[model samples]
Target chain A: MEKVIAGKPITVNEEGYLTDFNQWDEKVGEAIAAENHLSLTPRHWDVIKYLQNEQKNQVALSIRRVGKSGVVDIKELYSLFPNAPLKTATKIAGIPKPASCI
Target chain B: MKNLVILGAGTAGTMMANHLHHHLKTPEWNISIIDERDKHYYQPGFLFLPFDIYTPDDIIKTVEEFIPKEVSLIKSKIDKIVPEENKVQLTDGKQLDYDVLIIATGAKIATEETPGMEGEEWQKSVFDFYTFDGALALRNKLRDWTGGKLVVHITEMPIKCPVAPLEFAFLADSFFKNKNMRDKVEITYVTPLSGAFTKPKATEALTHLLDEKNIRIESDFAIEQVDNEKKEIIDYGGRAIPFDILVTVPTNKGDELIERSGMGDDLNYVPTNKATLQSKVYPNIFVLGDASDIPASKAGSVAHFEAEILTDNILHFVKGEPLTEAFDGHANCFIETGNDKALLIDFNYTHEPVEGSFPFPGIGPLRLLKESRMNHMGKLAFRWIYWNVLLKGTHIPFVSANMSDSGKHYEKALNE
Candidate 1:
């Protein structure tokens, strides 16, 4: 589904995670973060960049992986994005939520 | 003769050994399987062990019993796999060179990964049913214990037989009901995921079942630590759920041998070409079962399907041909949902299980995503089949290695 984010139409899934990474930008990410009541900071940007890099390289993202990524510890990640850090961060970064096989 | 060494004689390795032994015979290729353990466990039986539905004798069998006589079974602990040298070093100061290596070491619960999990109250109040010993101990504990807060928890995702913990909770409800103590126990199913399952349809069905059974669900809980003294599991989000008896599935990781070889991801799961089952770093090395970091569920049904495809791929690789047959991550599992009923789900990499018929598809017999007594019967009958047919690489009747979409109900967009 396409929704207006940062005054531009962006494709997103039902959960508001951007379906197309190409539509994602710093402005779009900030807008998404603001939706979750988070203001983008340098530390948040670093983690977002790391997540985007991992997503680009086709590495599956998880809280465990991000904690070990050295970009941000899990505690700091929770503080950065508040509740449901991975889900909120992935939404802000325009990546798919890390899913488990059912 | 060229050597093909298979590591671990568990379900995957045993099936592979049986599958390959017929195709790659004697003087051309020498097949050898190595594992430190002597007993071959019917791992699914571990779920029923705690409920006393199955005894230890029913699950434990000699590993050699399943292996073909033509293949060499090396009983030794592996120290490391030197992929660069194409050699597997044994702990007893021995090494075996292999032209082709199939690593099927599988995944195991790592209690050490979670702090306070294996602490003072390790098996007293805290228990795990993932292993034979753990299940047996839990059985003994459940025999005379007065029930209280029964927390059936999963510490992380990608655990083996993802439905087992849920089944444990379901069976627990019935078990207590049978013993006239249903009202005494408060059952809670805690998970890292947002619902009863990962898939939308299954989660909806299962979540409803949990509700019907009066089992409360605490979802999206990423556990930080288990407070042994307080008898509560604290999550990273500062959510603490108290438990009188915590039957938890700790973080499952691939064999440490993968990590020691420096050929694994963070969880020690080897990176593999999901379609071909070939190690991403080494073409000659193939990873099967839970050892590989595939998006597929780490279950016996998955390994069973993989053995069929990997067998064909191995033959193709040996003949200097491109691996054409791709494993679609087809897994057919029966989820036991208490009260002599179960839900059979057939899914692959892309497909989510929906309501339909299985094996015969449109024909009746086994239903998918809907609980039935026949499905439960199928689950029980699978034990006999696992030992007698599946381990021998015999194809199950009507069940294709690749998932069949003919009998399944799928939305047009998802049918692809």
Candidate 2:
């Protein structure tokens, strides 16, 4: 189904993850973060940018990798998005859901 | 010349197929394994599902991919087992005659057994992580759910992966803390046991971890029913604990077919000689995995260890030789403690988890009953090993099926 985020039709899978990466922007990220009851901080954006860059390179993201990424450590990443750091972070970053995530 | 039929193509059944195929000569022994489903699940991955550490594809694979090509893979639901006649009846009215039978049909979460557990609040407010569907549903639920009272509970003991509830509590603490809602979410670790775990030493260590995380421990809580309207879990003692969201490990019971076959105990688990893994009533039938009523944790590690012994015993039984090898109920598990750390516990029927180094004793590497980052790495690496090695019946080096006391700290307990 499609969700209208800031008047832009964004497609999502059955699990409510983004289907199209192109449809995501700062406004869409804000909307997604709001749904998860999170207000993305600068730290969260750093993790989001790291995830988006890694996704473009088709690299798998894990807690250990994120911790060593130089952008943000695992502890700080977890603090930024508590529910599920990699999952929630990727969702708001407008990347396709990581296959490693169930 | 003879037939060996194994029911349920799960962890034990799949391994047995690969192991026995190599051990038993083909054409002389017709080996067949049966199950209703085509997919095999990496059950331990269920714990990581709700946490989004593992995806659905990471945990599931086709059963045929694991079963040896030499072994006959029968895709059909079992109707009954006629032990006296050495025949198993299928749902399609097909009766398969066997010289020997192995029951590996594992246990499942019995949610309906608890009153009001599967009521209107099921999958809405209350959920289970024991099943693939339940795990996926919980993933969705936790995705948008804000901070509140999160209860990680177990309805009874002897459930599969007994430490998973504790792992969930630990991971939830880390998860909520990462979300910056640690204060908003009041986490509770509830169980039917008197302490945090079944074993005393492990319980002491685990309870301390629970304390450190500010997760309340509600021990010895035997839930009578779930009052979904009020979102309260009422115990047998009339104590009620309210929760905004409940993640439960429901009562675990063997396949219903075991009940219908009249070959199982009260919980539908087969009554087998604990050491031999052979059925007490019928000599030709053997039991392994969660299907057997053994005093071992129903984890994949136990099944892997049992499979090694049962394979040797089956060959002895076929040759009319005495079954010599005994299964010591060795169970090895890595408990995820959150924050990129986990604890490794290795114990058996005769030994309790102690503080020491594993494999090499005091030399180094994985620590027993102690939390460490290496242990967490081991936990993550196990998923790869499970898929590539364990199911293929390959022996993991240095790790024997029996518990080793070498290099372990046993002074205090042994002196007593």
Candidate 3:
């Protein structure tokens, strides 16, 4: 199967990323987004999952802030936040209701 | 028996070498400059080289070509600095004693500080533009490659020329469009800073430029390591950024020699008096440029201003008098925006970049707090002046060592 992402030659064996962490880049998360038609919310599960695993890249940049560039979240953007937003928030504040949407 | 020996003949050392040559009375005072290499580079020009604006020949020249005849030039690597004995040992096993010493043996790029950054992706897929070789390598890659994910990442903070990465992103947009490969290429700028830049005003201005170019910005990315096997840069939180090409600014640290001498801070930078360029531990030792832990901007223009004030302070120090010359962190850089336009901002230690007219208040050949084609042209013109005027310690008209408030329309500015 041709990988959605470009296959890097740095891997140890013929398999996937079970070897080391240094081989990771934002392109892996981008492959997941590309499978869908650029949908950032529900279709962005792979992005958030990878972000939650990393923890350092959590701050959300404002789209309206600069107004010059529109950057797609090509990395693990979901877990980079404090928690996912209420629309995508894993845990809802003040109440414990299993909201099926998130 | 008083002699001043400076280590490293880079921007800071060369400026001080010229400044001292002019200020100090000859024969009575002897100044010597030392570095391992013979060539001196105009560091600012490295950013423009990838775009075919500057040639490699335009940026390099022998260190001795700039040094005045009166100031002695020694080409040798420093083995270690013996601060307690007031002597420095050279790599050739020769020890040179100094009555007064200056440390300008600036910062170095340690990509090894991060995991996998220097691995298989280095230069082949990942690149750096800080060095001549790095810039040249990227230039060759950009020349032929069709395009894919172009990630411009800053691994950590306190890097040399912080804005160059953003400039690269802007220039790449202009470059790819010219090549008719804009659609094939996706450009993203990643940094540890909260916004597009360190200062909020400049960040706001720069962030706006990123949007205009359709370039993406990823902020607060503290790289834990480069996941080479996955072909990604993974964070501590497990976030990953995969790159078709990674142009990274690795973590900058003071020279390793400083660390060996046991005279530097958490980084290899020496503890310095921010106002006066004197070493905190030793009275006779002075530090400048990226070698010191000064809060000033780490650019060639900053070294130019610091050299002006430091010459006077060093004179006072020798006479056993109090140091009077105060180094105002006076600095300004012409921010190059693509499409033949640039922006200029003037600020100091206390002052943040404010929007107003520069040098001249209402009427200006150059505009302040805004971007103009004229400002962009000025950025290009500075290369000529840097070679002819700045290194020789000849003062440019209106660019005082101390930043002035007269021209800026501060009435519109909020009262401090």
Candidate 4:
């Protein structure tokens, strides 16, 4: 579904996660972060950039991998986005939610 | 004759051996399977073992019984795979050259990965049910013991039989009730995921069941350490959960041989063409089951499905044809929800489990996403089928490899 974010019509899934990365920009990301009650600090941006880069490389993202990413440990990740850090961060980063498969 | 070597004579390798032996004739190909152990375990029984629902003899069988007599089975510890040279080195320094290699070395629990998990409290209070020894040890503990805080936890994902931990929780509820001590036991299921399960509909259904069974859920808990002194598991987020009996499914990783060979990702899972089941680094090598970094559930049913698609892909590669991108990550699992009832889920790469009838569409004797006694019967019958049909690559009568969407409720899913 298309919703106006950052004053642009952006396509998102039911959970407000971006369906396409092509439509994502810093402004769009900032707006998404605000929705999750997070401010775009430099540290948060660094993690977001790292997540987007991993997504670009087609690497499956997980909390374990992110903790080992050197950009942010899991504790800092929780402190950054608070609840469901991976899901919330990925939402702001405009990537699909990390699939914690069955 | 050209050599086709299979590593790890587990579910995946044995099935591949059976499938290839029938197709790849002896005059043209020589098939050999290697594993260090002689005993083949029906791994699903590990869930029921702790509750005394199944005996050790029911799950344990000779590996050789299922392997085709025409195929060679070599029992040895594999050192490493020399991928470039297409050779496997044994611990004794012997090497076996192969034109085609199938890496079916499946995943196993690494209890050592977690701090204090195997510390002083190991097997006394802290336990894991992923292994046969662990299961039996837990069974003994549950025999005469009074219950307190029973934490059924998962350390990480991509674990073999992902639903086993939840099943453990459900079965625990029933077991304690049967022992006339239901109120004495406080069952708490802790997972790193946001909910009881991954898929939305299944999670919703399972969450409801957890509520009904009075099993408390502690979600999004990324465990950091098991404090033996305090008897509590502390997470990275500073959440600590105390338990009298801690049952955790530790981080599951592929065989250490994959790491030794430098052919795997961070978790020692091989990088493969998820569709074709062919190794991304080498064309002649194929990986299936928990060994490959395919985003499918690492369950026996998945391996069974992959074996079917992989068999055709291997044949195509041998005949100098393009590999078939046929594997759709199909997995069908029966979820045991305690009290002689289960919920059957059938899904694939692009689909979440939905509410519907299975195999027979509207006329199914089995229901999907709903609890039933028939599904429970299906779960019990699966053990016999695993030994008799699944290992031999025999197709189940009604169930096709690719998931059928005919009877599923997808219309409701599309809107979500």
Candidate 5:
């Protein structure tokens, strides 16, 4: 299915995960965040940027690795995304769902 | 030539296949294992799926990779087990006779037993993490979910991995806190037990963890039905607990084939001797893992321990000798307490979890009953150990099938 984000059309999987990473932008991130009832702050952007960069390198994201990434600690990451840190952060960052995620 | 047939190539059955393949000679005995599915799931990893601690690949493997070449692996669904005829009828109209039978069919989550549990809300708001699909579905729901009343519930006792629900609650607490929505989420743990856990001392320690995390507990909650339209779980006493998202451990019962065989208890678990692991009704039939009606916790650790005794007893029975080995129902589980910290609990049929160092008396690594980072690491490291060491039938260096009292501490009056 397709959803309009930031006046641009983006494709999503059956589970609502982004199907195309190239279509993602800051505006798209804002749209995703708004849907989840979250307002992305500077800290969320830091984690999102770090996650997007790590995804390019094909590294699996984990709570411990995110904490040690120097962007933010594990507690702060949880505070930013609440229930699903890697999932929400990656969703807004416009990366493919991490294979390590259920 | 004697035929030894094992049912359900799960944890207990797979381990038993390997254990016996090495012990029983080829010409004298033939061993075969049967299961409907071709995949073997690392069931403990199910708890981490919704939280993204583990992915599907990390917890699943092909069953053929684990079953040794000497043992025949039959992939077929069982229709019925005719114990009187000493044969098993398959769904495809095939039957296999067995001189010695091992029923390791294991237990399954019965979601349909409870009213409104599997209603229209199922997979939408009402979810379970017991199965692979359920965990994946819950993961999808959690991705975009805003904080609300997320209730972790247990339907009844004797479920596999009894401590898993508690682990989910702890992880949920950390999960919400990580998102800065801890204040928005109201976490409640509802159980049918009188305490936080089945045992006394462990309950005291775990109850404290719940209180420390500000998680509410509803004890002795016998759920009569789930009011899906209202999003409330109603108990037998007419007490109702409402939730926006309900994650439940549904009622667990043995495989339906056991019920068809007319050889199972009310819950479809085969009545077996707790120590010998032999079926109480049939001398030629044995039960292992979650299929057996043993008073032990239905955890992988208990199944591993039971495999040791059952393997020996099976040999003794074949040789027409007395079965001497006994199982003390040893079970050890790591309780995750969020924030990368966890607590280890070690106990058996008679003893509750206590405080002390494990494996050694004074100088040590792992601590019991106290939360520590090492325990969390140990819990994570177990995935590697399970695949490489446990399933391969290789003995872990320090751990034994039987619980030991060497390093355990007892209070002055409590000791007597």
Candidate 6:
């Protein structure tokens, strides 16, 4: 599945994210980002420090072979959106406040 | 209790917030949206603004209006993300912790990346349509300006809306014509691409429109510098393209936040699983929208698709289940070809843009890789759809997250 570049059939409900990873343009980014050198620009480093300094328990993932994905966060999501489903779905089975994501 | 903290309240973040806020358990699960700005600009409408297709009020909206009210909103600048700590530090000295952090933080315009782009002529003879002020300013210049050499240039590859430059050229031709200056203005399109676009077939189709509109094109012209004083744009080859009005698509870079995190690419984009929207450096951190390094157009539709898949996978991660969703790099865009018609192209990672029908196959209300009035209306109507359906995180009835092949002439993947 990782190697496959096939576009799968999809039917999104009323609300969803903008682009699917399968259809997003990360490779295009690699082709482009590879052309840009950050020898003088220390912006990437700033991101690493800023993102890490904020999180208390970031769950680390592997880096892409070329390192060109769009967003990078390093924290366990549990602490971030504490009110999300997998955390309390069983315990709070019947509340109707709708504070978090569906 | 679990928390889902989504960073950046742009198109991707907003949609994910709405989706999860509606689906995730309440009280026990909290969904918070964090962003730096208070106003939301209908980005796609930026393209139309310079051409007078949309008014300022039409494109501007309060960010709070589009964000789901149920989701707690944090109007603060992110100081840094301490992945090791699973928390985010705000500029205000406050702290927000998350259980599952979704980084939908999008891309940024790196105007300085190009050697001469940031020089004197910036916002003068030189301009960018990527921002609201830039677009609005260009509109005023286009309205009263007498015809001369109008150069629509692309500083490099991987900029958002690959077809936008061509659309700008096409629409400019129409704009001048409406202003009774078409015969007076000499239009030229300069790009770093080997041709009109990355895709060969679409390039051939779009290149024809350029020719038909008498729009001169300079391909393979890598930018060297912007000689703002001389009002000239020089290519790496030492060739210079002089212009009276220069509408340039400057360098596009990932957010500075990516650089702060130190987990991004040379251009400051994060490294992630191309298909999973999962962070390449952090499993719990997922990515979507213009932020990813995926090889596709950085268009609104692409973000729309990825956010859906990322939302589902985030759910799977919470359950300790393997993510089943796979993104195929599907992106679709409507290229305004002037004369009240536009071209539609739909493709994924492996497939190139091919001629076909969309939404409805044989009876497509919208054609693919072909120019038509319907597509033009579709492009115009997108502004309305973006504000009402897209930003609200509400789904369009027929459009799916994945690219449909029913009507497309799915040639064997060329760039595969």
- Sort candidate 4 into its docking category: medium
- Per-residue lDDT of model 4, residues B226-309, tens digit only: 999999998887889999999999999999999999999999999999899999999999999999998899999999999999
Note the chain A TM-score of all models in turn. 0.95, 0.92, 0.26, 0.97, 0.91, 0.19
Candidate 2 residue-wise lDDT, A1-102, digit = tens: 898886788898766788888888999999989999999888888889889999999776655457668998655665688635677788899887654210
Candidates 1 onward: DockQ, in order: 0.65, 0.01, 0.04, 0.68, 0.01, 0.02
Q: What is the lDDT of residue B238 in candidate 4?
A: 81
Model 5: iRMSD? 14.1
Candidate 5 scores a C-alpha RMSD against the true structure in Å of 21.9
Ten residues in sequence with the least summed lDDT for candidate 1 chain B: B407-416
Q: List the candidate 2 regions with Cα displacement exceeding 4 Å.
A: A1-102
Error of 2 at B71 (Å): 0.3
After best superposition, candidate 4 residue B207: deviation in angstroms? 0.8
TM-score, per-candidate, Cα-based:
0.97, 0.80, 0.80, 0.96, 0.79, 0.79
Find the candidate with the highest lDDT and give its number.
4
lDDT of 1 by residue, A1-102 (tens): 889999999998888888889898899999998888889889999989999899899887888889888889887888887768888888899999877555
Name the regions of candidate 1 deviating beyond 4 angstroms.
B412-416
Best by DockQ: 4
- Tell me what fraction of the real C-alpha contacts between chains A and B each candidate also makes: 0.58, 0.00, 0.04, 0.75, 0.00, 0.00
Best by TM-score: 1
Q: Evaluated on chain B only, what is the TM-score of candidate 3?
A: 0.97
What TM-score does model 5 achieve against the real structure?
Answer: 0.79
Query: How well is each residue in A1-102 modelled by candidate 3, as lDDT tens digits?
Result: 123243553332232221333544545434433433343454344434433332334322221111112222423333433222222222111111111100
Residues B1-416, candidate 1: write the lDDT tens digits.
99999999999999999999999998999999999999999999999999999999999999999999999999999999999999999999999999999999999999998889999988999999999999999999999989899999999988999999999999999999999999999999999888899888888889999999999999888888999999999988788999999999999999998889898998999999989999999989999999999889899999999999999999999999999648998988999999899999888888888888978869858999999999999999999999999999998888888888888789842742
**Per-residue lDDT tens digits of candidate 5, residues B101-141?**
99999999998768899998999999999999999999888
Stretches of model 6 off by over 4 angstroms after superposition: A1-102, B411-416
